[model samples]
Target: MRSNRFAVMRGTALATGLLIALAGCGGDSDDKGGDSGGQTLKGVTIEVAAVWTGAEGAGFKKVLDAFSKKTGATTRLTPTGDNTATFLQTKIQGGAPPDVAMLPQQGVIAEFAKKGWIKELGPEVQAAAKQNFSKVWQDFGTADGKMYGLYFKAGNKSLVWYRTKAFQDAGVQPPADWAGFVKTVQTLSDAGSTPLAIAGGDGWTLTDWFENVYASQAGVEKYRQLSKHEIKWTDPSVKQALKTLAEIWSKPNYMAGGAAGANSLLMDKAVTDVFGSEPKAAMLSGADVVSANISETKSKVGTDALTFPFPKTGAKPPLVGAGDAAVMLKDNKGSQEFMKFLATPEAAAAWAKAGGYISPNKALDLSNYPDDVQRASAKAVIDAGDDFLFDMSDLYPAAFGGTKGAGEWKRLQDFLKNPSSVDATAAGLESDATKALKS
Candidate 1:
């Protein structure tokens, strides 16, 4: 399975720019009459659900607005909080699932498909996916040999966003390796600035931190094994990653609010600490979507704020990628049409132009991105191709990956608060993961 995914990535990377020219250009078809097989659905209303709120939500609304104009369909975005899976389950059980949902994890797609809740996409959507997306993306949406979803939004999590002024003040360039990263942190602190802004209040952010470090230090094969539970969390590789993380996380002086405040600081505020007036920190590590959080601040993206790939722990830095897949919960013309639209470059372009968005659609023109920062982030994913790994937590079941105050989320949060017990953290992770994956 891993080899097949990698093969597709390599092919996709090789064909990036060339595919756009060959993908015949008519994504907007406006024939208003019924039975004309046109995109005109004047009275149809499509309800979509996703975990995106704030800037991300507002950006997606632009895409829906574009779709509405092209198809005449009324669209509503029902913002599901961080626990989207739980919210979705409640709606499904109530016999009122949204027409479509943008699920954050591939495991959720498999879970829903196994429960017979998600519908297999029709041929049109499937074909559009084939034409625009790489086989790796298609595989992410497939279950038991059938495609059930389409990945529309992609994020590169191996980025560290830093203030340009902080770098200048500290006389430091972005670090190229783990050792240099550590020195950079200390240097920034000595220069009278907090070195990092950690969104410890949100467990998933910590998970991303662990993933980048683990993937780079342990190598991709071991990373894949651990992700599948083929290797226990107590393995030596896991221990090493935890200790590596502790190098910075264990130091309170390196973070805004000295760890305690960060434990309660949500992502937006953490970002603001770095970019807002009277900046408190020099850097924030997160997915490419962190740009959306940065957008909410007075920071000008390309000039005042910029990103460097996560520093290398091994021979090369790991590019940890993630995405949201659109799945159909109710089979109808309107839902199918919307899903098909999402598969097109035009749809991806709509959101890309709105800023703070990335698409894994190989056929998408990179020129659609608003700035060099956005384009560089998108290119890093495309260029990494077969070498990329999706967010590790998202690859696991919700019990282990998505819940709050329980499972991996809680266990990692505990690890953050007390970096003293690597063994206990590993044992706890393995214990919960074993039980969750088994059932």
Candidate 2:
């Protein structure tokens, strides 16, 4: 299946401007009237805002069209701009918010909940979601004891995507633990191939590696606690996690270029560097990049790609995936109806068919997916229950997690350049995080 290794950990948030536009356009329609047709609701148009455009956006539009036909309610879709978080914030502050917004980041959801800008899904929506989705959706959407959102689809992050033929040629098996994973990297390097392809320019992608290391070393729950400030930055496990990442990057031919030069590579280019040109690279540790890059290159799907669960050091748990939450802005009839529709099995099935990633809902059968990799990914997301950890960036404060936090990326780069300065790097991160929390 196409690995969700990166997508699952990268919680996406809608841009603020797009969200505001949706809210402004749909607010007046919420109060119009009930069903004008026989048993079908009408005169109510729900403004739906999403961060997707192009093919994915078209898929969402298809779902909206289906919903409109089913309820006789007109649906207006506004494509959120590339800057998803900013657009949503502007929309919320402007008092023009979409009735239903799909927020990719949990941090944004939590902030909106705190400000009372978004409405909680009441009894009707809650009942439908519980009936339709797994407990993971409910758990992720709940904040401060209220259900504010629902998980529409999920992505698994702790996976390593590889070229199947390369592994066979090298006579190396996928690693199951930290030691073996390192050995595999060395084996690939010894065979004259880049051991790993990393996209450091997209800072968020690099954050995934940090999260994986933290999760592997400190455990998922502890990592969550650390993000929330329940645990200190100075915690031994956190330090060790950072140290482990540094050590791994230090290995000969571990990364495409040594860690210093790897920072220049972009996510898509990184994938091509490993899979397209260097056929013997063996693997790329990323989320769905294999499939995404291949598709982008117009290469046939599910041909040379394979994925293995990310290896850990101790007490390994099931792989964790990240997903976006479908949030409600106002608890009017229209909003409630829309949310209920999202909870239905039909919505999940439609999402699976769209082919970005698998929906988190276990009820959606993915037998129709043309690609075996995506189908397997769907199964993995369904099977990974409470063990799943949404994107680590989402778990942390927005200041540090968002694009504005270039300092975090700089710290990693600086450390890579001079390993002896690890102490300064840790201290700076802790200080910055403290400032972020306070602000």
lDDT tens string, model 2, 315-414?
Answer: 7743655666778887788888888878877776665565655677666777745578878877776776666777766655556565433445566666
RMSD of each: 7.9, 5.3
What value of lDDT does candidate 1 attain over all alpha carbons? 0.81
TM-score for each of the candidates: 0.91, 0.83
| Whole-model Cα lDDT of every candidate shown, in order | 0.81, 0.66
TM-score of 2: 0.83
lDDT tens readout by residue for model 1, 268-385: 6777889998788999987777676677679989999999999989877998877889999999998998998898888899989878788998889999999999999998887777
- Mind sharing the TM-score for model 1? 0.91
